[model samples]
Target: MAVQDGPHQASPRKEPGCLRGLVALVVFVGIIYAIWWFTGGRDGDDEASSTPSVSASATGDRGGSSGEWKAGDCGGPDPDRAPDGYEAYDCGDPDATFRALKIMDGSILPAAVQCPAGTDVIIEVSMNSGSDVKPSGGIPTDTVCGRNLSGDHPGDAGAGGGQLVKGDCVTADVEEIACDQAGPGDLKVLGLVDAGSARCPSGTTDPIRLTIVVGRPYDTVCGREP
Candidate 1:
């Protein structure tokens, strides 16, 4: 029998390289897609990555104290006993009120209240500086102390009210303070009655006292005396 001529057949071209390249491309694409899915795809909002700081809302039903304090009224170490240097007082909770009473006997004591995180503070200085000397509410912008600061009490007198803040103090020039004030997040200084002229009721110069209402954000200022 005549040798049957094999049907004409062409050798199959090797496409392994192409197949390998395609596999590699798929793997690369899959890896890139996985990375993208894990990274920037979590949050769908178009907003910037940074968030702004915001004031926290007041909680609880406790109303703060409305008056100043005497030296004997405070417990433990007096907040005003700064040793010839700067000392800081952290009054937690905005609803909580703090008072600093310093008995001025020729020694100068400066104290400040600090608000930690999410809180603003403002400080007012009030004191009975003995003499008839009155603290001139000085510059209009510097009236960040005493009464209502939001201009709610327009022309209202004394270390008036202002925005509360954090890390601020009310310095004193005299003995007794009425109601000190502060705003959230702001560190302020309230001017006390000048001890030089403002004398005490006893004829002996009185000490400087400061009352701080923590937690409320105010717009008042404790500016330097003119």
Candidate 2:
């Protein structure tokens, strides 16, 4: 069986990697993504509360909060329910009520919304996303966090948005470069490409198989291309 093609999207080529202090760039299907620097605003406890960290605060408001908090808020301990009125931090501290990493586009929501399964997305809100952005004009809304492309990698993962991915090419950066060497600053995932909505062609057979075109780019990188 031939390897099915996914989104044909390709990341834009930027300068070589490995420059400190330079903002990163990720190219996918021609779209470029910068860093994930949106700040979640101040925590919302009016009174004193426990200091909130990414982990501890993430679980506090799974149910959701009113628009009282914007996109960047993290919740502190429930002052009314706790033995002490104040959470770890007094009211007014950024994390006192909300711990913001970045602000998002949209109105505040009453509850946290979850992205559906098989969604072609990169970022999952580790903390609460204060506002829920609707599918503006019917575009669909996914957490815009996974914009950054870092961490240990399998070189290649399953296809997304119908794009066949492998190591670095698996990223929108399909071009050849010394990613392991580190230059153009750390790479980020621009977006998915080769977007074939249907995993298999219409009236196709089962057990869909895919192949990495030999002699294509990434054939020699890491010495493991098929």
Instruction: Give the winner by TM-score.
Output: 2
Task: Give me candidate 2's TM-score against the actual structure.
Answer: 0.19
Q: Where's the lowest-lDDT run of ten residues in candidate 2?
A: 47-56
Q: Candidate 2 on 1-226: residue-level lDDT in tens? A: 3444587753444323422213332244113211111232334231111111221112233224522222333444344534212122323555453233333332122112222222222222222333532211112122221111223222223222211232222212333233344343322222222224323223222211223432122221121221
Q: Tell me model 2's lDDT, rounded to 2 decimals.
A: 0.26
TM, every model:
0.16, 0.19
**lDDT at residue 193 of model 2 (Cα atoms):** 23
Model 2 alpha-carbon drift over 4 Å, by segment: 1-67, 72-74, 77-98, 101-190, 193-226
Q: CA lDDT, every prediction?
A: 0.26, 0.26
Task: Supply every candidate's count of residue pairs whose N, Cα or C atoms clash at under 3 angstroms.
Answer: 61, 55
